[model samples]
Target: MLKPKRTAGSRDLAAIEMRRSLAQRIKELTEEPGEHLTPIPGLSLYHRTSPTPCFRASYEPGLSIFVQGRKRILLGGTEYLCDGWSFLLSSIDVPAQSQIIEASEKTPLLSIFLRLDMPMVREVLSRDDIPEGPPSAHRQGLVVGETTVGLLRAAMRMLELLDTPEDIPFLSPLAHREILYHILRTPQAGRLRAIATSGDLVQRTGRAISWLRENYAKPLHMEALASTARMGVSTLHHQFRALTGMSPLQYQKQLRLQTARLRMLMDGFNATTAAYEVGYESVSQFSREYSRFFGLPPIRDVKALKNVNTALESVV
Candidate 1:
């Protein structure tokens, strides 16, 4: 006997069920209200109860598949919302402000994040069968794309591998390839592709960005950065801004400030100590810039964060 033809409504219902199932899996894997690293390297699950204030955060090259809740992320100057209906992909490390805008005890935010392996992406892209995705019009480092059923299914397969750790070592790569292949086959693959392509301008600029991230505490030398990118100073500056929406100096500043903020908030570093630790020679100058960037001085900002944490802890 032949099966009955499925209607569009049935397809939509199936998709909804799959998302709910994925969300439940994430929630089960994360029994606490924090990040839970899985057996899969660089793959983690997150659960958050209640909305959160904006905080300084950095994105590694990764995929964020949000099965529930929503977040507001300001990357560079653009704002993106990551929710059950959308997936966020980052092609490189970037400093940004993010807030959990929709979450609660009754309906906590549950999601999966997988750090992208550039080498793996390149290998997958080299396959004879893989389609060359559409050329990107704007090559921003971070993009939010509407989720599709195929992508979800691939992600679900990866998540299931957690059930059999022994199988993961052999099977995880294949699953990772499928997830990446899904993205690469779409128009959204541009940044990931460009960065993975050897000697591509974006790839070179990505090297410069990585160097800046590693050495933000040291004095930035334009010549050294340009040399790392293997591009002229002017070209490096233009391309850096094109992909990251900031100059090299500006990116370094954000990285420095965010580092100092974390040190002060988490490591008991005072304002002057944090400032000098992050390569600021003058504490007063650091104070001025810190205030300008974070909307408050270091002491006040840290105090606010602690209080927020306390309130959240009490609720939890």
Candidate 2:
């Protein structure tokens, strides 16, 4: 791909340095194949080969960038992919499944995950000259965007702090803010701007999502949720579906099933118990839905996941 013309400014110089640093950091961090490393506070980096087609998992507000290979994510039946030149940004909580689709032993997939903290979001929003109005609603929680010089640079600086632990306490937050600024100034800024703003429809929808995440197993009333989000029931339903591509009920169901699967796999709960814990009342209904969602019966699915974990441990 042809390089975009670089501007002649100090920011440009800093951006170049930043990109070089990021590329080097990614190379060093990804040196070992099949390793997942959490290099810094709230940042998880990984290099993988032959990763499974992962199920839709609850995604916290975060930024995800792939330095090599590719990732495909499915959200609300929509598919999105990001590769070396692209990044995926989720500005709010979402239910999605993602997998490294283009990696092998010869060339492992490389990626980084950054946690989104509300304090930093507020700090970024506090700056003067804030952009006004709600950004257009985008249904896909994962968005693939062309990686810019600015963002690449900030990402590198953030990783560079890993080598200088002392600076992390002071510099990491600033670098993170720069990264967010880079994002807000990009073409996809509108989507993020919507997320950054307080009391916007998107942010309101985000509140509802947060509540469901914490109370997935508990029964929910539409009006109650609407009230919590500060929107009327009808408007909440319309905007929620517009932003997530699923009605509130569908979103809750996805969360319920995903959480139930985790309870079974990680906590070793029986299928019936897991289903009930996740708020499913009928064991038969749970079994049928679990099978449909996971493409295997609950017992078999748990067993398969355990086998996979065991095999990975053996290799390690």
Candidate 3:
């Protein structure tokens, strides 16, 4: 097998130094304890001063570059740990549970999150220079890959634009493109390319997933979903599970539960109110499943989550 011009071994030494450089800039820019949106569109810096409780999160199509500490995320049955050496590419919107596994006031978890430009990715994939590889069997929306020197360099340059605000207007887009190019150069690009392509099976499955995400509260009809994806019922089910690791019903259930949890926790809704609001017909059914899913009854879970942040307050 022919390797790319910059092999894995070649990028290692430089990537180590580059990660340190990027981490410093990110930490300095994100003085607050949460995600800080940058001047550049679709880019954000995250800083966590302490390990956190597992929280439900929805990851849009983006890249998460971790430069310090670690995070553990569970998507379906798979558990992924992202530390300083790696990055996670989300080719589609995915619901998961994530927690900060490593961090402290002295050494915070520093990361850069940049949303993908599917059009830009498609443009790069169209270039004559990018060789067509054999079809990849990989279909998961989220994939982890080693952070290369090129990726770190691109992210650092993007972050630097924060200092010179004027340059960001003209230069940030170029930096964003550069970051996308580095992502395409990795093996995980195969999954990204599938989503970017117009009519690929994975892309079709992505459409159904998107529909499910947007309309999870509505009654699900397999025929309508298969029609949306331009796939037969069996084919849709197979490809959907292949790409998302969850059946459509299972996916919708999780989405409903997470949304209900958020409403109750953040919006001050009660258990019964939150249940019916998220399309549940019965409060008893919602409570039963909520306990099974979150390991606590609704009121208790919300109460526990409220206190979960107390640990971080001490560090502040």
Give me the candidate number with maximum TM-score.
1
- TM-score-sorted candidate list, best first: 1, 3, 2
Candidate 2 — what's its lDDT?
Answer: 0.74
Q: State how far residue 191 of model 1 sits from its true place (Å).
A: 4.1
lDDT of 1: 0.82
Query: Which model, 1 or 3, shows the larger lDDT?
Result: 3
lDDT of 1 by residue, 175-248 (tens): 99888877775557775676576257877887998898889989999998999999999999988887777899
11-77 in candidate 3: lDDT tens per residue?
A: 5667778888998898789877798998898998899888877777778888999899888888776
lDDT for each candidate structure: 0.82, 0.74, 0.83
> Which candidate model has the greater lDDT, 1 or 2?
1
Q: Pick the candidate with the highest lDDT.
A: 3
Off by over 4 Å in 1: 1-11, 127-129, 185-187, 198-200
Q: TM-score for all predictions?
A: 0.85, 0.75, 0.85
Which residue pairs overlap in candidate 3's backbone?
A: none
Worst 10 residues of 2 by lDDT: 1-10
TM-score of 3: 0.85
